[model samples]
Target: MSELRKKWITAPLLKLIKKVLPPISETEREAMEAGEVWWDAQLLSGKPDWDQLLSMGPPQLSEEEQAFLDGPVEELCRMVDDWKISFEDRDISPEIWEFLKKERFFGIIIPKEYGGLGFSPTAHGEIVTKVSTRSTCVGVTVMVPNSLGPGELLMAHGTDEQKQYYLPRLADGREIPCFGLTSPEAGSDAAAMVDRGVVCYGDYKGEKTLGMRVDWHKRYITLGPVATVLGLAFKLYDPDHLLGDKEALGITVALVPTDTEGVTIGQRHLPAMQAFQNGPNWGVDVFIPMEWIIGGRENVGRGWYMLMSALAAGRGISLPSLSTGGAKMAARTTGAYARIREQFGIPIGKFEGVQRRLAEIASVAYVLDSAHKTTTRALDAGHKPAVVTAIMKAHATHGLRQAINDAMDIHAGKGIMDGPLNYLGNVYRAVPVAITVEGANILTRSLMIFGQGAIRCHPYLFEEMLAAENPDTKEGVEALDKLLPKHMLFQVKTFIRGVFHGWTGGLFANSPRGVGYAAKYYRQMDRYSAVLTLVTEISLLSLGGGLKRKEQISGRLGDVLSQLYLLSCTLKRFKDDGSPREDRPLLEFAMRAGLHNIEVSLMEVFQNFPRRFLGQLMHFLAMPWGHSIRTASDRQSHACAELLMEPSETRDRLTRGVFLGNPGDGVDLVEQAFNKVCATESLRDKLKKGGIRAFNREAIDAGLERELISGEEAAELREAAEAVNMAIQVDHFDHLGTRES
Candidate 1:
């Protein structure tokens, strides 16, 4: 075993890393210590068991779930459209709120026996995606209660009595719940919160009993203003020795009624253009029974763990769903607008520059939607997948941000305007909110994904560390004696796998049976997976505990892992959807993009590695194929862009359920007009020959009225003209009260 350790080149480098790198912070250490190994942990370990992943299947929605979506959810969406919820300062209308409460929109995740809808994660994701296409404000309203609130926490860690009392109320809308976790001073570092609760004797139902006096200041609590109940997390103190001799029992979670004395509520916060009911709530020495603690006395000092677990479950569903909605909307609307809104007498979609953006929008929509479905399906299969969820939350939102920006660029001036007809404006403004919430994208990428993932996901690393740290020397040596040989053999296997995959370009890789064209992508994924495993092992061995402080290295490693997962999902989506030939361009584009990103991340890791010699050797071993990996070609981009140039069954199928807004809205109207004017070659030729260059209503009408064109083309020309006119128009607003005066 000692000889095996000596043979590893990174052994001495580990000691060197410990001497040079800063010590790991307590928060970082805690995060690493939290959560058990999940599926992502296994995949990143270089064991690409394709059969097991494929067996999970696509996300399934039951008949009842479909009926609910087509019925009540659909009806609610129509109501939002009719109400024009996007323009309202109050966010959702009272009538719409009542409709949502009556339909039990807030109860999607609660169990049926608890008087709730008991919907699966797939159903939950579908509902959020469909609703988000209509109004972001309304989407946030529906999303908040179902994710990271009392309902989710209660279901996971609540006492039976608490569940019975609170679950039904939450499900039926008798209680609107909001979680008070993020303080103004402690947004991401929740452990730094100053909210405190002291155990003492207090009056409960007119009887003297042991209770807690809690004081809290929390901000950015979604649903805060209207919440009937607050789920509070605060540090608990037992200075009087009321609960044993401990002075502090760490952070604890408790339920507090909003109507309690000295509690302030209903302070609204307007987030950018969004009017969601977000604000601050504070309490001054409010008393609560000991029973209010999430899991009663037995679960004290476990609030952080419970919260992390709840986040693990819900984060994979809500934000990803909303991001999927944004991508789908961008794809559908931008594609149609590009085809219809012509410039230089030709559709802008035909231009190489615009085509590049269009292709990106379409491809982003495909990849993100695939990721959302695959992750939700995994959740439904009963895997919490903490690291996977963090990656999805960060990457999906980032994808949405890029897709919407591309859509805005395609729309040019029209996308920036705010109005009833401007569909992309609201979504554009909502991008920052998604990027900031659910553990902010920056932190998730730089710290959590690879930081926690490296330790939690590795098969033998954590065990080996535990054994090395054991107090009994003989036992510690025995454990290492058993683990070191297997670890050495595993490293050898991974190196060989990497060599085989690199040499063959993944041709001989072990992948599940699939279409012949997709096989190479699977093999490439396998090769990268092996490379990631080797790099991670080398990183752990070279940096030891100090790797936790090397966030740049950790973040790059996360990028490789995340890209692998995204690529895997892309392949799964292609195969699961029947491997259509028309969609091959998109699949190819995603594969190239993912592989290129993996290569870039690996290079960054090697460039920044502390030990130069080991880094160079490892890079050589990993990239035996060559250092430079190829990206998607312009030809591939053009092919994907061509698919989005016109309204086709494939386009509609790809962006299936996005609400394209009303008839006069830019998206739907432009699509209709483009299809109409291009129906006949004579119409196109006459317009081209007549030299009607501009894309306005008058030029199209003038071209049709000329003797060069016939009467049958007149109606199509007029409708196309009107649609173009509406597409370029923006809403007008008066300055303050000047117009009234």
Candidate 2:
């Protein structure tokens, strides 16, 4: 056996493998090594253990966290005016800022031992969602400190003294913080940064001190204008070899006080007119003590890993929460408008075209909420999940953008006009901001999602790369001999499973015993998983190093993986929310859409593949019986739309956590009209039965006199009709843009 392995596997296999191995750059290698994998790795394994997914605890807030959201978060929302903040003020009020600091809103993730709220990851996401629903500007302000800013970095890698001193200050808002990582030349590529810091000796308060002379120019910083401290990233160099014999150090992080000499701040940039305190800042020959390094002097040249680790919080929690909030708000308000506003003597929502858009909005809301909840729950379970975080950031923002566009189409003139009553206009404007931040959607979808994930989540690819790169040829060959056989077996098994599942329509795929409504979805996802695994291996073998440059193929693969994850989240949400019969329409819509996307994305990849035979082979294995899944049916869409157009527990749960102010407000008016319309459904049917189609006040009075309806019922119907009319009216502003001055 050993002799057969030596000739057939060891020498020949190693030579071929080395020739096919892709070259990984320094930055790419660092990124692949940054965060640990979790459930994403399970899906890549082609046989996810359903028991593990079921074992994860559902996300829940503690009493203290719940109270904080109920009390202070609610108060903050009431204090905010989105129209005023976006247009007139361009920033939150002084009182709101003071309230946030006092309530520890900026320190939701900080531990209580410091001066913060110590909320769990789920609570933190909840706070962001609720606040963002009320005011995007204030939400950005609050989320920055709690997310990728100094507080998070400090908690992850700061020295003990740095934590003790800085955490309390950051928690109490004595020192507002911002992080600077994106230089002009390095928006998506941090390794291309030109910002620099040179190690040198400098005079401190009294004596000579060791520090770096740093110079940096960074833009798009969220809280740059008002930050008291800056978390800066710059390439480091030691020309004199001050700390080490090596001249160049990699990226390094430092904590520089904004008040220090040669530090710049106090300007703002209006991002998509959603105006938070975002701006650019500059540092010219700034001197800092060595202790100011985030993890101290010994931790120099490790800035990229630190930033990558800290990014999981913002990417996975804050932005996704904000997107979810916007989607839910759109679903609620658009549904209300569609029900009350009539055209051609009937509610527009009854029209098929309008129903399609409304259904899309509701399904997007449902899916975004589910993904947000599931990802945050994973974070609370102590998993960083870098690839999952990237997926969440890209897909949630994209979903929000889609939902907002559909909502605008449904709202028509009401959506076009901008005023205090325009609840959706600001969110629509903020869509680009969400898509552009954390990571640009284009770069993330094309490169980061699949490029990083393919190696990080794959079972044997990373090991093979390490083995191929080993310096000793004999050692590398031996390692590949062992790995090659196992890898080939895995590929063959996945291919067979893919072909069998595709032919049988996933009838034989595994499902959890008590999944109930979710059983079919589980089996479908398993079939897709096997297909994805088989295609991934074939593509790697066919494309090798060129796969990195084939971003279009990578992006399509990302879509399939993203849809699988979203579908999984939808199933999890159904079970966790008690699997209500009323919510089945939403579940069906989300699942069907996800499966269709997976099929379409795979087809697109196959069509564009470089290797013709492999592409055709993948197609046959993925869909042996031709296209089996189609988009959601119109019946399913109308059902989802009906849930939104009327008052039901399902609608209430889907739209929960958004701010609904007093009765006169836009959202409140819609809510009131929805309730009134639902209450009078049977009354309208009674009038129709009495042959009184158009029930004007006179007709209602006539019906009352004829005893077709009672006096109280006539009055109730008249009141309901009036409420619907009032709810359909949009606020009109004068040429000066003032509502009623």
Best by lDDT: 2
TM-score of each: 0.93, 0.96
lDDT (tens digit, per residue) of candidate 2 on 654-677: 988988865576677777877787
Candidate 1 achieves a global lDDT of 0.81
Which candidate wins on TM-score? Answer: 2
For candidate 1, write residues 442-539 as lDDT tens digits: 88999889987877787766656655454245565556566667888988887787766666666677666755778878877888888888888888
Give the TM-score comparing model 1 with the true structure, all chains together. Answer: 0.93
lDDT of 1 at 231: 94
Lowest-lDDT window of 10 residues in candidate 2? 470-479
Candidate 1: clashing residue pairs, number: 0
Candidate 2 positional error at 17, Å: 3.2
